[model samples]
Target: MPVTTELILARHGEAHCNVAGIVGGEATCTGLTDQGHAQVRRLAVRLDQEHTTAPMSALYTSPRRRTVDTAAHLADQLNLETRVEPALRGLDHGEADGRPWTAIKRRFGGRPQQYPHRPIAAGAETWNAFISRCRAVLRRILDKHEGERVLIAAHGETIEASFALFLPLPLDDTELAGQITGHSCLTRWQRHRNTFGHDVWMLAGHNDTNHLRSPMEVIT
Candidate 1:
């Protein structure tokens, strides 16, 4: 049976901090770059065209500037109001929040994923705690919006979390567990009942960036 309950996750476009090689936590994020805006506009057009056939029921976004900006473009295209979910925000970087990745690496000796059990920085979120919140937020979304096609404009890590939860993949704290989600890429999942009547979430697509492949644009 076809599943009408769909969940689409879109990673926010490139931000200034991304170009500057800094961690874009809530305290440091400055929103999307012009190129990022262009990338998302293309995605919005694609979604708008697809909406004629499979309209989305709701749109959600994290409170970060980059995510909010990405959601704004999507909202305009889909004619849907953007609902902000604090739980959907990216990992809390704590003391590393506005610091350069290079500097942080020099201090911490490796990436945050390298030390999953510990904080990336003072007052930061641990890998375990972060994945737990991600799972909880996704569960809440599925329960509240069952049978409806829902979209979320969120961070790359949030999208990663969805894959971990819905696909029943291990939340690997020691390293990058799955493919890194690209900027403004779309990942889709559909929930359906299996032969035993157990609910299952099937991956429809992952890291889809077809809309950004125009001749005028260069994916970087």
Candidate 2:
């Protein structure tokens, strides 16, 4: 029998760049804010209460500080070790890393008409490259962890791109760019073979923040 794989995708909590309104990539703006810590702890508490006896198979996090911090709270509660995944990191903003949004426009001749197709920074990823990385991550998870439950801590755009890999929607790059994945919110997906033996990825949850009990629950 082909078993089902459950994928839990959690967005990292708020970070310095979120408050500063600047672009981020690499190790820039890595630490989670105080509220971010609270958010992740709330999520951990919820998971602890619900899954005290059942620990997930693996915990993977983006190699950035914010995501690492967020994953730590959950991993500690569940007694699981974490692995850093570069494919799970956020989009690289390149030249826009430290510039304010307004300054970014002035410097880059205006924010690329579409973040997916345009690079706000000369060294940043094109939308296609971003999706490709997301696909790679998904493929790895499917191939390696079938029938298991796995948790991932990643970025907003990364989550959106991952969704794009499996969702059969009319969402354009504009729609994908417009999504706001709240801090510490959790999204879930399941993978199983269909009646035709075709592999399918189905969404089970999206942006679930009910675990949050603080102002951090406010979607940014």
Candidate number with greatest TM-score: 1
Cα lDDT of model 1 by residue, 27-52, tens digit: 98999999899899889888877779
lDDT, residue 46, model 2: 73
Q: What shift in Å separates residue 20 of candidate 2 from its native position after superposition?
A: 1.3
Residue 119, candidate 2: alpha-carbon lDDT: 71
Instruction: Tell me how far the alpha carbon of residue 40 in candidate 1 is from the true structure, in angstroms, after superposition.
Output: 0.5
lDDT of 2 at 76: 84
Which lDDT values do the candidates have, in the order given? 0.86, 0.75
What would the per-residue lDDT of candidate 2 be over residues 171-219, giving only the tens digit for each residue?
Answer: 3454244465899998888777878888777877888898875333322
The backbone clash count of each candidate, in order, is 0, 0
Can you tell me which runs of candidate 2 are displaced by over 4 Å? 1-3, 105-115, 168-178, 192-199, 214-220
| Model 1 steric clash total | 0
lDDT for residue 214 in candidate 2, whole number 0-100: 39
